[model samples]
Target: MPELPEVETVRRDLHRLLRGQWVKNVSVNKEKMVRGSTSLFKRNLRGLLVQGVKRRGKLLIFSMTDDKSLLVHMKMTGQMIYQSKQTLVGGGHGQPRVKRDELPNKYTHVVIVFGDGARLFFNDMRQFGYMRLVNAKQLEQVVKRFGVEPLSKAFTPDKLRRLVRGRKTSLKNVLLDQRGVAGLGNIYVDELCFLAGVRPMRRADKVTDREIVKLHKAAINVLKRAIAARGTTFNSYRDGLGGEGKFVRMLKVYGRSGKLCVRCKTILKRVKIGGRGTVYCPVCQK
Candidate 1:
């Protein structure tokens, strides 16, 4: 699944290309890829102007001129490709570099036509992604579900401390909960813990005040770096331009379980916390 950075990358790229374009038509090859009534979904999107694109958590919100929005979640193995005469940008999970001609292939599920004849294709190999049309009032209710975005200014050391002050869960599990701090996934969580020198298995309540500050700083730093690198691409994570991100090569512990730790030269160990695979350097993180 595309986390915050990857999803934000797609949101920004889509905003650059699709914003201000009027919807010419809508087509759904697989109706299950859409949520709510299919007829209403098509009806709300056609002729609506795309004002902008926003992202909440891992979902993409398409603000429209008609007081409605298209909420899209690329669950897994999903790809969103925008095509035009001279430019092409595809974002989501699947393929490091997607070709323009290869689009609308077997995975193509939903296609949105623009006034300029450009089309945006939604492809999901696993068929788990879905798009829902929501009204202005409904959009408000949806946005409230997400917690504080770590990349936003609302997230700070004090705020981070307050969120997990009394939590008895492991640090990894606490960080994974979107209700407290949004946008953290397994990949970046491991990196953040490594950067802050905090063990993933430690309880949130047991983390020292200094460690909290470090974790706060580390979270922002890791996320900013990942976004700058266009997000980590391991199996299929891609940017809006169908370009693979460069952060995977910079990962320290996420997938380096049996590898040597960069800081202490000790072999990284992999363990399971909160049922998710976690990697850490035993000698470096305590």
Candidate 2:
């Protein structure tokens, strides 16, 4: 899964290549990938100019000039490739093929044609990703269930403290909860807790005020750094241009289980929390 940073990187790259482009046509190779009726999805998007691309949690928002938006969730193995007149940028799992050679691939699920002979292709082997059309006013309603954006100004230490208050879930589990704070997955959650020196097994309500402040800072800092490095490419994450993110090299403890801790010489330990793999330095985290 392409957590928040990877999703944000894709959003930035897609926004640059897609803005102002008019949607000449919309094609859904896999009908299940379309959220609503196929005809309604095409009718709403075709001929509408793309104004911008934004991201909420792990969802991509394609804002249009007609006050309608296309929300795309690239779950698990979803990839979006853009082929323009001059260049091609592919991101997600699997290698990207040219527009003409796209549909032959088993993973190709959706394609959107632009007026300038450019095409955006969505390929997902898992078929769990989705594309939906929503009115501009309803956009908030669609994403309201998600928690605060970690990168937004609204996510402060005080806010995090209040959110975690009375929660009995483990700190790692709390961070992974989308309803508590969005965009954090197992990778970043472990890294955040490690950086904040908070043990993953520690209950959220047991976290101190100072630890909450550190955890808040760690979350934003880790995400900012990951975004700068393009995001971690562990299993199947890539940027909009089919590029692997460099942050995996900078990872502290996510996948470095049994490796020597950077802060302390203790070996990092791996365990399961909330049914997800977790990594942390036993000596450094406590």
Candidate 3:
């Protein structure tokens, strides 16, 4: 799954290539990938100019000139490819195609054609991604289920503490919960816990105030650094330009089980926490 940094990178690239572009046509190869009524989907988006692109959590928001916006979630194994007469950019997983034959193989689910002959392709090998159309103002209602954006100013330590207070769940599970902190996946959560010196299995309420401050900083810092490095490309994630992220090389703990800890010579350990594989240094994390 593409986490916050990966999603943010896609949002930035799509914003550059898609803003001001008018939608001439919209095609859905897979009906399940369209969230709303097909008639309404085509009617609302066709002929509308894309004003801007923004991201909330792991969702992509394509603001249109009309009151409606397009929301897309590229779940696991999903890819978005942009093709124009002069350039080709693909992001998500797999290799990019610069030629017609190079287009996404059997997994192409949705295609949006622009007036200038450019096209954006949404491909998911597993058919898990989806697109929806919603009134711009209703976007909040649609995404209201998610908690505060981890990178936003509103996600202070107090907010995090309030969310986790008295929770019996493991700290890793709390961080992975979209309702507790949006946009953190397993990899970043493990990395964040390692950096904060908190064990993934520690009860949320057991984390102290000072440790919460450190955890907050670690979360933000890990995400910011990952975004700067274009996010971690462990299995399938890539940027909008179809480039694999370089942050995987910087990982301190996530997939480094049994490897020597960077801070201490102790070997990192991997264990199951809340049914997810977790990695941390036993010597460094409490």
Alpha-carbon TM-score of each model against the true structure? 0.96, 0.95, 0.95
Error of 1 at 132 (Å): 0.8
Off by over 4 Å in 1: 95-97, 235-237
* Model 2 regions more than 4 Å off: 94-104, 235-237
> Per-residue lDDT for 83-168 in model 1, tens only?
99888888888643467787688889899999999999999889888999999899889888888999888998998888778989
How many backbone clashes are present in model 1? 1
**Model 3: ten consecutive residues of lowest lDDT:** 92-101
Supply the TM-score for candidate 1: 0.96
Clashing pairs in 2: 90-242
After superposition on all C-alphas, the RMSD of every candidate to the true structure, in Å, is: 1.4, 1.9, 1.8
277 Cα displacement, candidate 2 (Å): 0.4
State candidate 2's TM-score. Answer: 0.95
Residue 125 in model 1: lDDT: 87
CA lDDT, every model vs. true structure: 0.88, 0.85, 0.86
At residue 5, give the lDDT of candidate 2: 88
